[model samples]
Target: MFLGKVVGSVWATQKEVGMEHLKLLLVQPIHADGTDAGTQVICADRIGAGQGETVIVSRGSSARILISKDSPVDAVVVGIVDSFEYCKE
Candidate 1:
């Protein structure tokens, strides 16, 4: 799992049958301190995460399981973050 912000959205009129019902989002990975960590990733959203909202992303097999084991998703927005606090050392 990782922290990220929804940067954009994806629209696909033609997609696999298993993917048709999912909302795809472009997410920018963020560090615990709220800094950009890496390149953006496309994630399937089932929790209604909107653009600019902070979300929790799950990758790999776990992500695929969110929808189903047969789902074609490699990343998924598992949760919408309400708040975050980082403790500096």
Candidate 2:
């Protein structure tokens, strides 16, 4: 799993059969301290996460399994993050 923020959305007029109904979002991964970690990623939204909301993401086969065993999704927004605790050193 990874922590990220929903930065944007993706609109696809046409897509694979199983992917058509999924809401795609652009997420910017962030560290627990809330700093940008790297480049943004496109994720399938399952929790109705909106832009600017913190979210939890799952990648690879784990993400695919949420939709179906044969789902082609590589990443998914599995949960909307309510809060987090990060220990500072």
Candidate 3:
């Protein structure tokens, strides 16, 4: 799994029939401190995450399993992180 933020959205009216109902999102990878890491990817949203929300992504076959144990998804947004606390030095 990878940590990321929902930067934008994606729409595909002509996608595989099995994948038609899934929502797609553009996710930017983020560091532990919540800073952008210069990497971004488009993933299928299994959990209704909105723009600017920090999320957890699962890639490869595992991503598909996140939606349905019997279905297939190359990448998926599984969780939305609510908060992160860092201890000061």
Q: Each model's TM-score, in the order given?
A: 0.96, 0.95, 0.83
Candidate 1 achieves a global lDDT of 0.94
lDDT score, residue 30, model 3? Answer: 85
Per-residue lDDT value at 74 in model 1: 94
Poorest lDDT segment (10 consecutive residues) of candidate 2: 64-73
User: In candidate 1, where is summed lDDT lowest over 10 consecutive residues?
Assistant: 14-23
lDDT of 3: 0.85
| Residue 85 shift from truth in candidate 2, angstroms | 1.0
What's the TM for model 1?
0.96
lDDT of 2 by residue, 16-89 (tens): 87898999999999999999999899999967899899999999999998988787899999999898889998
Clashes of each: 0, 0, 1
Poorest 10 consecutive residues by lDDT, candidate 3: 64-73
Write model 3 residue lDDT over 1-89, tens digit each, in one string: 88899999999888775687999999999878877887799899867999989998988878877666666567898899988776757
lDDT of 1 by residue, 1-89 (tens): 99999999999999886998988999999999889999999999988999899999999999998788998899999999999889999
Better of 2 and 3 by TM-score: 2
